[model samples]
Target: MSHIEIFDSRYARLKAVDWDFTDASQDSLASIHPYPARFIPDIPRELISGLGCDKGAVILDPFCGSGTTLLEAQRAGFESVGIDLNPIACLISSVKTKELPPEFLPVAHDVYEQAKNTFDGYVDIPTIPNLDHWFKPDVQKALSSLLTHIDEQSDVNLKNALKLALSSIIVRVSNQESDTRYAAIDNNYTANDVLESFLTACNKIHEAKKRNSVNLECSKIFNQDILSVLASDFDKPVGLVITSPPYPNAYEYWLYHKFRMWWLGFDPIQVRTFEIGARPHYQKKNGQTEEDFRKQMSSVFDLLSDVLLSGGHVCFVVGRSVIKGKIVDNAELIRNVAENHKMVLVANIEREIAATKKSFNLKYGKIKTENILIFRKD
Candidate 1:
């Protein structure tokens, strides 16, 4: 049995307050990319408030899938560091937190206009797996033309922003499965669908820039694995570590976004080798199991202990999984590992999983709840 302290008061407060931000328009930066199992920004906002870190204190998200935590930290006037192994994750995080001038919108509009003017020009498409299966020939040409125009831009921020806009639309216009699911082809869209989606995404960038703050200290996003980077990455002490780690065999971000990666000129095959907790790791033939996941996460906890301050707060957003006909409580596992490193569990706050996210999983049963395990470093 795991010895853990349950903070009833904190759990009650969290439950009373609405975690859903349906009314609040998420920053356009977060919407720029599609990511699986991403928690709402309010989770980070509430955790940061509860932790009560100073403005200058640095916040860190070790598994920053799409920069939701980093963006929220910056908006709340705190410096943040986001580290992810996925290159696409790093790109999305960069565009989300990167400082852009007021003139960025108009310049982006000019770039779009130039792209439209030269849409007829030939484009060099990267060789990708099943390229013909996912994209219609004309759709590919349109996307390629947009990418070519995006490449012409000299400004890093603007170029990346345009690239993100393209990423936001790729899956929608593709023959691949829906945004939530991967691999299996389902629907197809015309070339106009691709163009319209790209333009709409560009408009989102404009809206996101409206809330941009020049005074917010820039956030640094790293494309390296957490184990390698958390060892000695930050010069400043990390005050709060808020993140939602990938579940065992539940999601593979690289596989889900392979088409987007191919369109963006990144090799998804390279990321697959190092991606932790992928579905294939659960196969009996692969000779990996839940124990592998526990070991990997234990390593992450040990590495994070090095950078986080002595009294720093760690809020892990995790859900329980059913493995081998038994329930695997990830929160309990993480608590046990943290206790070994002299960290005390302050709360095991359980919250209901979002209705939309509670999809059926044949192997893992169903995830109906998530635990916000709050810990204090001793």
Candidate 2:
């Protein structure tokens, strides 16, 4: 199965696409990112695609951030399972994989009309006492009405699909620009217009899928820690293991997503406990100092070793960040830990991801390029 050697790809040297995805502009409804590197726990699917895609084969993404790795695996025709600390991530993944019933859109449209009409005379939604700061009153009311009606539906799949739709809208409907803090609305407001965000997300989902002619494959997202779930025995061996772990000096998955976490069914407080590189933890502790990060990554690697199958592969993509006037060479030195675990480095892919202006003033302030390290078990 060529399991002995690390597979190579054009993306290894040049940041090239390894698989086929229709143009984002062509698929107007899709939530495809302008920046591919934004994907958390990413797998180079185009590179992995060259490995092979056999039906019934399975794949696992331990750090499956919003399902990018899982989606690619499924697109490659393999059954896949994903786990993430963020509930919004799990929701996004789950909704993306579900193959909406043919009648879903038409039916949902009817519900949309009902929601709009219900808003026609009401003028305002119930005052969400805590939410006025983030959204206009009219927007909040429009959202609640849709959420209430969507909940009234008896069908579970439809309900989830509807929820997924709603979840997708959080970015556009709010003062939140990107998934970053600067892109957010005034936090002083306690109530977020969750219901409105949900309906907008639902509409986006239907539109995105329709544009792609995508038949989303079956997959499941667990809103739990990968470490806790790894002990469970699976019925099949995952043919591929594609995921990117948290990078040192980067974002805290929870805080970067705290607002989203609070709006969804998840509790932001609980999510904060598990998120890596959280700003609070970063500042409170030693920060991403060389010694601290090395120690932390080593343990995480060991935990990962326990989950991977014999001879299976683990690909980690990371970037160097300036922390206190020094560069954190995550990919270079990480091999030190890999060797300790008896893992071999197959390849190192270099690339870049967007960074903020403040990032530039730091020790590694340049919009630093990242690396994709492919490790295979001996």
Candidate 3:
């Protein structure tokens, strides 16, 4: 069959499958922390089940933003691996899959008490730009004190969990416009009640941990760029790979969480230089374009193809991008790359943009469609 006819057949097959997941809870353990542009867990869950991965097979999410795929794979009783360049993303993913020890709750309560009692104690806050504009004096003090107390916890897992919890509260208490927007539109929203917000966030994390008590020991999440980590050996061949890679010229993730990363003691600048598919990286001045996107993604696909087991599946949830009046079909781009790597297109389903999941505004033009492109190794 011709390539156009092949694509049409796959598109039709995807349309016939039910993509509705209104009944699935968006408030899973993965929801405890926030990350921009996270795909729904139902997509990965269904893909894994549909692929029919055998017991002990390894599932991989190369751009595992916020651990959505990892959490779903764990719940389904499979070992999973996630790789990302963002430290905060790694932290959130790690915390999501953590199985709370018996001592987690009591220890968390103790830490909370320490933080409240030592609320006045001072710690050197990271020197973030526009710090004063984003956080009020009192809010800064409370956050520093809380982070200081959280760092005091002896258990690394519990400490990181609290840190993740603290990261969640940053947006609620800052001058940032919203979760999706990179630029801050100050509406005079100051977190006057920082302590209360921190406490509430801690309680929510505790409850979320209790609710998602699955043994997530079957997963390994790495805080490194995808290209850097592809050389590491997996215990078993990857049976399935699923992820939502960043779209070209859209969503500057590091800038979006700049203050949050600083508040939690992370150097956002360190990862900024190597962030794949960032908007600035594709600017005309950068001497890059949509073709660069295809090249970079092709390299990653080559890496994935090398590690994948025979007949294993790769699924990418990507959206079309419009830059300088040129439209790039990301799904088709990925399909072409995968085909060159000896993979067969399985499906390309265009799905409606969920009301809550719509993050891009008119400034970025309308992202009227997203494609879930599935491919199997030949």
lDDT per model vs. reference: 0.74, 0.58, 0.74
Off by over 4 Å in 1: 1-30, 54-56, 181-193, 211-214, 357-364
Sliding window of 10 residues with minimal summed lDDT for model 2: 18-27
List candidate 2 segments past 4 Å from native: 1-37, 40-43, 53-57, 117-130, 175-203, 211-216, 285-300, 352-364
Model 1: which residue pairs collide?
none
Regarding TM-score, does 1 or 3 come out ahead? 3
1-378: candidate 1 lDDT, tens digit per residue? 112345545434444445443343455555557776556777888888767564456899998888888878887788899988888888888877887655666765675666566667766777878788778887888888778878888888888878888898888888866876656565667666777778888788778766665367445788887767655667777889998887776667788777888889887887777787666656556555667778888888887788778878888988776555567788888888888878878777666654553311223547776777888886
lDDT of 2 at 242: 64
TM-scores of all predicted structures: 0.87, 0.75, 0.88
* Candidate 3 per-residue lDDT over residues 154-231, each given as its tens digit: 877888887887888887777666776545555543334676676677778888878777775646787887767664
Pitting candidate 1 against candidate 2, the one with the higher TM-score is 1
Q: State the lDDT at 304 in candidate 2.
A: 58
Per residue, candidate 2 scores C-alpha lDDT tens digits across 67-135 of: 667766766667787877877677666666667666777657766777777875663344332455556
